[model samples]
Structures are given as C-alpha cells and as structure tokens.
Target chain A: MKIAIVGAGALGLYYGAMLQRAGNDVRFLLRRDYQAIRKDGLSVTSPNGDFHLQAVQCALDPAELGPVDLVLVGLKTFANHRLIELVAPLMQDDTCVLTLQNGLGNEELLAKTFGAERVLGGIAFLCSNRGEPGTVHHMGQGRIRLGELSGGFSERATALARMFNQAQVPCEAVDDLRRARWEKLVWNIPFNGLSALTGKNVTELLRHEPSRREIIAIMGEVIAAGNAQDLNTPIEAEIFIEKMISATETMDGYRPSMMIDRLEGHPLELEAIYGVPLTRATACGVEMVRVRMLHALLELGERN
Target chain B: MKIAIVGAGALGLYYGAMLQRAGNDVRFLLRRDYQAIRKDGLSVTSPNGDFHLQAVQCALDPAELGPVDLVLVGLKTFANHRLIELVAPLMQDDTCVLTLQNGLGNEELLAKTFGAERVLGGIAFLCSNRGEPGTVHHMGQGRIRLGELSGGFSERATALARMFNQAQVPCEAVDDLRRARWEKLVWNIPFNGLSALTGKNVTELLRHEPSRREIIAIMGEVIAAGNAQDLNTPIEAEIFIEKMISATETMDGYRPSMMIDRLEGHPLELEAIYGVPLTRATACGVEMVRVRMLHALLELGERN
Candidate 1:
C-alpha cells in the first residue's frame, strides 16, 4: 500500500512509521520538520517499543508525492482552511482520505474537498507528543476507530482498518461515524477545555472535588446534547464519568493536546471541538448550558 | 466621631482618609501598610482632589484602638473568617460596623460577630487601587450605598451616610440591601469572572460579540436567581444589557477587582461573589449555568 501522511506532527509521524515498517511506501508531508526528518529520518520512542527508520521519504509539496492510496490527515482543525488546496494533488479517484484529527467538522471539510466516497472519519485513542524534530514520544495506548462518513461498513474503510491492524496499530471499523464523533466528544469537551482553562492536567482536574463534580456536570450536558441530536451517544453519565476518572487515575498526569497547544501559544480548535456540537444541540433546543459556557470561555481563551 | 477602618487596602485607605479629613479620629487597622502609614501618614490621589494627611492614626492591634463609634469592615471576604476575633476589641455597646465589601455575606458575618443592630451592608461604587504601602489612586466614582442588615433604614445607617456625605463621599441609605447586593452581582458575576478567566478588561469584553452575549446570558441567570429568592431584581435582561454596554463604552478601560486579584496571584473572592449566589440559585432550581461554570473555573484557578 502507498500512504501519504499529511501534517507530520506526532500523530502523523507515529502512525506513518508503523505503516512504513509494515512494508508500505509511506511519505510524510512536512513543514518545519521536513529538513530534520529528511536528513536524520524519523524515530519514535514508545512504551510498546522504540523504533527508528533511517531512509524515510519526505515531501515539501503535495505534487512531489502525487496520488497515493491513502491520505491520513492529522493536522489541528484550526489549520483546516488550507486542506482543500493542500490535499488536491494527493487524491486519486479511489484514494481514501482518513482524518484522525480531534473535534468535529474535519470529516465534513474533507468530504467537501474530496468526494464523500473518499472520506473516512477516524478517532485516535493515543497519548503522544512531538519531542525534538523528527522524534515522537508515544506515552500510552495507540488504537484507532474509523468509519465511512455516510455510515455502515465500506470496503475501503475495512481495508484501511485491516491495513492498520496489519501494522500492529489497533483499528476498528464502526457503523456510525457521526455518533462515534459525538461519543468521543463526551470526554473531549470537558477534559480538553477544562485542562486548558484551568492549567491542570487530567489527573489533577479529576482529583479535586469541585472540579470533579463540574466535570460530571459538563459530561451530563454533553450527553444531553448528543441525545438531543438523536446520536444515541451510548454511554450513560455515571458510566462515562467513571471511565474518565479511572483513565485519569491510571495515566500519570498526562496533559491533553489542547492544554499543550494553549501552553505553546497556538490557536485552539475551538470551532470544531466546541462550537459545532454546541450549535447543533442549541438548534434542537437542548439546554446544553455547561457546554455553551465552555465554548464561550474557550472563545475568550483564544482571543487572549 | 471615632472610626476604625479594618483591612487597610485601597478601599479602606480611601474612605479612612476622607473621614480623617472631616475632623474624625479615624484609625486604620493595617497589616502590610501599618509601618508606612504610621511613619509617613496616608496619601490619596483622587479625581475629586489629591490630599496628604500628615498625622494619620494607624494601629496594628485592635486593643490600641479600644472602642470606636463605627467600625468599617473592608477586608476581602476570604479573610472574613477572622472577623469575630479581629473586631471584638474594636466594638462598644453602641458601636456600628459597616461592610463596604464587594460581594455577598459580609453583613451576615458581621452580624454574627457583633449584634444585628450593629451590622450594616454597603456597596462601594468606586474605582481605586493601592499604588504603594500608604498611597491610594482613586480613579473614578466614590459613592456608597448602605443599609441596615435587618432590611430597614436605621438611624446608624443615616448617620453614617450623612457623615460620608459631609466628607464629600456620596452615600445613599437604601431600604433593601439584599436586593442591592443582587443588583450589584448582575454586573459583578459576569465582569469579574469573565475578566479574570479571559484576561480581558471591561470594555474589551463588552466589545466582543461572543463575550458580550455570554455576559447578557449570565446577567439573565443572576436576575432569574434573584427573582427566585423573591429579591425582585427589577431590571429586564435587555435593559440591563444595554445599561452595562453603555457603561463600559463610557468608562475608560478598567479591570475588575477579580482580574486584578488573579493577576496579583491572590485567591479570588469566589465563594462570596460566585459560589453563594450559584448555590442559592441552584437550590431554587434556577439554572445559572454561566455563573456555575465561572465558579468552577475560579475554584480551579485558586488551586493552580
């Protein structure tokens, strides 16, 4: 298989390295890391193991990598405006584009850029960060859940999932991608936004009593919003809270990507992560007050 | 008249100087500024005029100022727990205590310490800051609204207001102090919390579309909560929003006290300003979601 990983940040590099090691022709679309990776190649330090690739292919322009079989977009949603133009040269009629980006609206943007048939929505359940250029530190779990944009199992999504599994990267193909996005948001909206706003890591936030109750309240609001949209987000409030609490307890003070972005002075993916669901829930007359409040604060956080 | 001003911060110094200039024996109970004011006197630069009092009375011990005709409690509400012991030696049988603090529950604490008849609630409509140990810069208005905690106009309150009026500090004696506190909270909850959380000043918050809307929504919640408690906070949401917008437009860029506290790394008066009202509102089943969210974030801010 031929794969082009766009936005060669930690996620892109980590997964691209795995697929390349599995004997796929993987090329990284790079920006700041291009020169470093082109010279030294890419290395990943993971709990699973450490791996280094010495002869990785890199590209500064999409035209340099022309039409690959798969395009994995791992850019921050704030940078999605350039997606249509950036991904143009890399799409063949049957080339599958999977977005493992956080938050809402990425799949829709990709679908608008490419055809709906070529777009698959994916969620990365991994804890990873970029070390010095061309290096990725994979802290914990690295599984992916993917589905076709229009729902149901498709041959392309199955093949993509199978390819990821073959590369030893756990991947599951689900029937409802939109609902899966909403389900992921049940955790993202509270953990990601609160972490950035409060300067607390996941464990610290869940440990404090007031913040713990607030996290539950926020999760309740997110679930209400999802159920309002008939997405059937599947997890109950208590169960979801317990899951997050347990996860935070097990993970040793891990900071979410949103908090990392905030500390680095980068603009957040506010519109995609918070704004879209809030708007949809509000349109259905759901009282998603907590989510709305988080969205407002995050908007102010962006300005500051 | 003999007056004892507790908590000699910006507000304490501003009012104490005025009373002293009126030929009253005003004593400031100072902590950080005791030595400076005792040695160099208290100086104030105000829009009304600039004045330097050379022989200002200052005290570190409540025993030094044995008993005063009036004790003005101007400490931050977070420090109010020590009020019982701090103010005990400063009270005579007929001595009155006025709390010009910026949030809820100050009068109750005072009433619990000294009798109900001795406690009065006051709202300071002033813009001032402490420039140095014994220097205060009064930026804007200096009127105060005061009333007896038992909800009626009393002789002590009238006398206090008259004394303030004589000192060129416009003071009004109102019938309902609880409603007045709620009215003040209509402005305080949004401006103070949002300013601290977002790092935006009053004018900038009102100018931004999203924040402005959030401000209105929070104000509505406050009003609803007030009405729920039968305080009858009489302003409509639109009227209140327009009033705040116009006020911010006219006022020069001013940072709320909460924002200043956050910047100075001091614990915010979150419990008094946001927590009390939010709890009361929630008990009455009034969903002051924005206020609750702000309270949660401010709690986290305190922990951090």
Candidate 2:
C-alpha cells in the first residue's frame, strides 16, 4: 500500500515507520520533525522493541508527497481547522482516509469533505509520546480497531486491519465502529478529564474513595450516554467500569495524554473528546450530568 | 450579658468587640491573637466604622475566662474535633452556646453534647478576616440570623438578636434555623467548593457560562435538599439562584473563605460543608449529584 501519514506526531511517525518496515511504501508529511527525520531518520523506542529507520520517507510539504493509496490522520483535534488543508494534497482518486484521533466526529468531518465512502474510522489504543525530534516513544499498548465509518463489515476494513496486524501491531476489524468509539469514550471522558483538570494520576484518583466513586459514576454516565447512541451492544456499566478501574490501577502511576497536553501547554482534544460526545448524547435525549460537569470544569481550566 | 468567645478567629474577635463596645462584658478565649490582643487590645476596621478597644478582655485559657451566660463559637468546622474540649470549660448551667460555624451538623453536635435546650444556631453573614494578630478586618457584610437550634423563635434568640442589633451589628431572629443554614449552603457548597478546588474566584467562575450554569445547578440541588429537610418555606430555585449569581458578580474579585483556607494550607470545613449535607440529602432520598461531584473533587483536592 502506498500510504501517507498526514499528522506526523508520535502516532503518525510510529505507525508509518512500522508500515514502512513491513515493506509497504510509507511517507510522512512532517513539521517539527521534518529536518531531523530527513537527516537522522525516524527512531521508535518501544517496550515491544526499539528500531530506527535510517532512511525515512519524509516531506515538509504535503504536495511534495502527493496522491497516496491511504491517508492516516493523527492530528490533534485542537488543530482540526488545519486538517483538510494538510490532507487535500495527499489524496488520490480512490484513497481511503482513516482517522485514529481520540473521540467522535473526526470521521464525519473527513467524510463530509472527501465523501463518506472514502473514510474509515479507527479507535487506537496506543500509549505513545514524542521523544526528541524524529523520535517517537511507544510506551505501551498499540492496538487498533479498524472499521467502516458507515458501519458493518467490509473487505477494505479487513484488509486494512490485516495490514496493521502483519506490520507487528495489534489490529482488529470491527463490525460496529460507533460502538467501539463510544466504549473508548466511556473510559476517556472521566479519566482524561479528571487527570487533566486535577493534575492527579490514575493511582492518586482511585486512592481517594469519593473521587474513585465519582470516577465510577462518570464512567456510568458515559456508558449510559453510549448505550443511548444506538449501539449494537449496550455497554454493561458495572463490568466495563470495574475492568477500566482495575486496568488503570495496574498501569501504575500513569497520567493520561490530556493531562500531559495540559502540563506541556498544548491545546486539549476537548472538542473531539468532550464537546462532540456531549452534543451527540444530548441529541439522543441522554443527560450525562457528571460528564458535563467534568467537561465544563476542563473548559474553565483551559480558559485559565 | 456576660459572654465568652471560644475560637477567637476573626469572626469571634469582630463580634466580641461589637458586644463589648455595647457595654456588655465580653471575654475571648484566644490562641494566636492572645499576646497581641492582651498587649494592645483589639482593632476592628469596618466599613460601618473602625474601632479599637484599649482594654480588650481576653484570656489564653477557656478555664481562666470561666463560665458565662453565652458561649459564642466561631471555630472553623475543621477544628470541630477540638470544639467540645475547648467549649466545655466555658459553659455555664444556663449558658446558651451559639455556633456560627459554616454548614450542617454543628448544632446537632453541640445539642448532642451540651443539651438541645442550651444550643442556639446563628448563621452570620459576616465577611471578616484576621488582619494583624490583634486586628480583624470587617470588609463587607456583618448580619446575624439568630434562632434556637430546636426551631421556632424564642425569647433567648430574640434577646440575642436585640443584643447584636444594639451593638451596631445587623441581627434578626428567625423562626426556622435549619432553613437559614440550608439557604446559606445553597450559596456556599458551589462557590466555596469551586473557588477552593479550582482556585478560581467568584468573578472568574461566573464569567464562564458553563461553570456559571453548573453553579446554578448545584444551587438547585442544595435548594432541593433543603426543601426536603421540611423547612417552613422552600427556597425558590430560579429566583434564589439568579439572586445569588448577581450578588456574587457585584463582589468584584471575591475569593471565598474555603479558597483562602486551601491556599493558606489550612484544613477546609469539608465535613461541615459537604460531608454532613451529603449524608442528610441521601438520608432524605434527595440526590445532589453535581454537589456530590463537587464535594468529591474538593475532598480529593484537600487530600492533595
């Protein structure tokens, strides 16, 4: 596959590097990492294994790397305004655009601009961060749930998932993409919002009973909202929440990406992660009060 | 009236000085202000009028103050652990113990220990803070809604109101004390908790529409919880919330006492302000979900 990575942050660099190593034609349209990547190439530090691609296929301008078979978007939702402009030059006639961004509305935005049939939605469970320029640190978990944006199984989705899996990444093709998105949101809305707002890590939040209870309550709200979104299988609030809590506990002292973003003065993925989901839930007549409170607080914090 | 002021913080100092200037014998059982007050009397800077007592009656020990007709408790709710021990030595056979502490359960605790008949509850709208060691800054409002803890108006409550009114402090006797407490909480639980938790003042919070909406929602929850307490008059949520918001807006850049407490590394009145109210609401089958979220966050912030 002749693939193009549009947002060459950690996610883009790491995934593109893997695909490139698998002998697929992968090129990254880079920004801060452009000069360094062209010189020293791309370096990925992973617990799974570390590797350096000495001859990284990189470009500063998207037009220079024009017309790929696939366009993988990893742009921070805060910069969604610049997304279409960046991706336009990377599109071919039959190109598929897959967005592995956090939360909702990414696929819809892309589809609205580039047609619904050409878009794919993927929920990525990747714990990664950027190291020095041209270096991507994959701390843990690199799984992708790839699916058709319009829902149901498709050969294209399956082929895409298989490609990622064969490239040494955990990937699965899901029948219901929206369900997967909402499930991830059930975990994201509370943990990310709380950690970012309070600057408390996972362990510290769970250590306090009241906050822990609130975490569970918010998770339940997200689940309720998710269920109301016409999912194939409604999330079992009790089981899923417990699993998320226990999984978070095992992660040791972990701060979510949103927390890191806030600390580092990067714009948050609030619109994608919070704003979009809130609108969707309310549209479906579901009231997620606690989540709304968290969203409002996070918004207020961002203002400060 | 022979009155002894236990918990001689700013509230106690200002009120005690007012009563003393009214020709009543007022003695304060002091702590940090002991040396300064004893050496140079007490200073009160008020918008009403500034005053300095040349011979302020104060003692380090409650035992030295002896039993008095009235024992005014202006202690922070966090110090309720030491409340009984400190107030015991100063209580007389017919001493009316009036606690002007923030939040619920103060009257109940006093009533449980010192007999219900001897307990009076006063919700003072006093905006005062400690200046120098011997000085109290009466910045804004100083009005007391005095009432018997057991409910309904009484001669003692009226006489106490009359005394405070005669002392140049605005005071009114109320029929239902719990109603007044809850009414104050409808304002306190939101502003106090938000200001303390986020370190945002009233103006900043209200300036943001979402947080302002949340503040109103929490106020409604509190009003519901208050109405559930079988009050003589239920708080009208819409009117009360609007009034509270407008009143808060006029305060310019007002930081609540809890926010100041959190910033100064002082223990918050969490138990009295949140814990007690949450318990009461739950018992009454009125769920204050947003308030609980606020409470939980504040508790977690306190832990940090």
What would the per-residue lDDT of candidate 1 be over residues A111-147, giving only the tens digit for each residue? 8768788889999998899999989999988899999
What DockQ does predicted model 2 obtain? 0.77
Across B1-304, the per-residue lDDT of candidate 1 in tens digits comes to: 8899898788999999998998889998988988888889889998788999999877888888869988988888889777777788998888888989877878887887677888898999889999888899999988999998888778778988999999999999988898888888998999999899878898888777877888888888898888787663465667876787687777768999999999999889988898888878888899887788788778877876
The regions of model 2 sitting more than 4 angstroms off are none
Off-target runs (Cα >4 Å) in candidate 1 are A232-235, B232-235
Q: List the residue pairs that clash in candidate 2.
A: none
- C-alpha lDDT score of every prediction, in listed order: 0.86, 0.91
Label model 1 with its docking quality class: medium
Give the least accurate 10-residue stretch of model 1 chain A, judged by summed lDDT.
Answer: A228-237
Number of backbone-clashing residue pairs for each candidate, in the order shown: 0, 0
